[model samples]
Target: MGHPLLRRRLLLSLPLAAATAGGLGFYILLERARQGTYNPQTFSNPLVGHRVPDFRLVGIDGKHGFGSSQLIASKKPILLNFFASWCVPCAGEAPYLDVISKSGVDIWGIAYQDKAKALAFYLAKYGDPYTRLATDPTGRTAINFGVYGVPESFLIAPGGIVRWHIAGPLVPPIINEQLRPELQKIA
Candidate 1:
């Protein structure tokens, strides 16, 4: 048997060793994140490469509603954006959406649990860039689309196949680097 003092010392050192290893691992992750080489929000979407979920949403603020059939019938790819009037990031992406729309990309906006008046005000404040607008009052449609949160977007190719998805706001970098390249592949 080992000496009692040695055994006690060894047992005490084990916790310190574990703590040191854990701290090192956490530090490495933080460094990677700071270096822009790691994305904590990176995740895979099972819906990608599959058809968009079937849904029928009512129109918001007198805009025409949309359904899966419309997406499937589209002649070209479309960007389906799930946003809310209350979302700050959604507002931040508004200008980019307008620019993208002006560039001839189709964007369909879905308001998630937002009131008509608020949605109208939001659209008025931020230029309306959506070709069509729908309301998911119960957020059931968003649930079906595997939406993690508001301001998510899906790129649906002709026939309603979801080619790509982003779980965050569509900022300039994402639009230029990732979204445009993916659209080119389908185009």
Candidate 2:
């Protein structure tokens, strides 16, 4: 209903306005990232601060396995780790896990979608730090644990409540800065 030239200008301006808004949104996200307040890797799991879900996972050999009862019956805190032989980060964290285990912490490993043979070789090469190992070949146990991917870890308290979780490899910085502090709190 307006003049043709005015109508054309308005239509052209809409795209520019939309693009400007998009740019502004991107800038805000970038600023947040720069400020260290927005980590893209950070995700909230509903399982934190709650009891670990019920699961029965067979070990790599299918004969030796672990269940929810085993975890709940533990007298001390445990680190539940989900890893796969094929994950590079899992390999990277292997040594640190060994160190942590040496410090008297129990680490329970769940091999996610990995073959027994491959896991055996991986442990032989990387050094097995798990006090107990189980296999989650179908990843069902991981789903119950709310694991997003391999190399995720949950700190379970004496009674099997998941007090903390980290969705990455347990590198030195994480060991010293985050995991150690959490361990002290429970101790």
Candidate 3:
């Protein structure tokens, strides 16, 4: 019923439309992949060269309270770790942190979004590496630190300046390679 030239043009246009649809779908998939890689779970703050936030919190020891001021008063560099018992990455870093603590780096830990009982159990199981353990019952302390999740560590100098911030898990190589050198400089 249609002219031969018109029929040929229609067939050509159909292939073009299909190619455009396929291209669009591929582009969307690529964009999704990029977004997935930028997930918050993989993100860490750039706290280096910034002053550490100071705040008072109830210590896990239940006998004494603690704040950033106490760490600054020590006149020695400090490592402040934010963790939670429920966080798998936090658990993974605990043993390595215990090793680091023995080096006299003045490590302090803040329990974020955790129950007191769970915190006690975690410390008991993993061995408390922190010289002072603070509990953030309502997660307010973590919010102040600009924390979106657990297993973050901040390196603070004697003057209370945050020298480094590591988000997510702290692997042994990271401690040995990245953290150790920075600590040596501060020490």
Candidate 4:
């Protein structure tokens, strides 16, 4: 048997270990809160009201795809979305995106930080609503668009100007009320 003092010390250490664990959990929660709340005015590229960045990426069909110039050439408004299979918000917004695409808008999708197979699985399951799907293997295209996370969307005018940007998951109301009107104004 252990000494009585040693037994008491071991018993007391249980509460200390729990307290340490609790403290660590609380600290992690606080850090997450801070990160979530830290929204900056300027995105990486500050694309709003600026010309859309030129990029060429791989399409879902494994073809070389391009943005910006193609939209300008087509003389139509463009909706660009940054998404990834692993992003929950992106999945949440998928149905709304499908609706928008079906409405005849020139919608394009950029798969950010995602593998082709995963992107294919997501599209297969959720239905591909994009007129074109550009794969950004390294997420460099997302950085150009000032994207902090997946499910970020941009409305570009016929002149290739980025008119509006929405972060996070999108809903039908947001699309109809805010995004559609903004696109009309730019168009």
| Pairs with steric clashes in candidate 4 | none
lDDT (Cα) of model 4: 0.79
lDDT of each: 0.90, 0.89, 0.80, 0.79
| TM match of model 1 to true structure | 0.80
Q: Write the per-residue lDDT of candidate 3 for residues 86-124, one digit (tens) a residue.
A: 999898888889889887777888888788888889889
| Cα-based lDDT at residue 91, candidate 4 | 84
For model 2, residues 1-187, the per-residue Cα lDDT tens digits are: 9899999999999999999999999999888667444448779889989999999888877568798889989989999999999999899899999999999999999999999899999999999999999999889889888887889999998888888888878877677777888989988
Q: Residue pairs in steric clash, candidate 3?
A: none
Model 4: what TM-score? 0.73
Steric overlap count per candidate: 0, 0, 0, 0
Q: Against the true structure, what is each candidate's TM-score? A: 0.80, 0.79, 0.74, 0.73
Candidate 2, RMSD to the unseen true structure: 6.8
Instruction: Write model 1 residue lDDT over 1-187, tens digit each, in one string.
Output: 7899999999999999999999999999998667444469868779999998889888965657999999999998999999999999899889999999999999999999999999999999998999989999999999999997889999999999999988877877678878899999999
Number of colliding residue pairs in model 1: 0
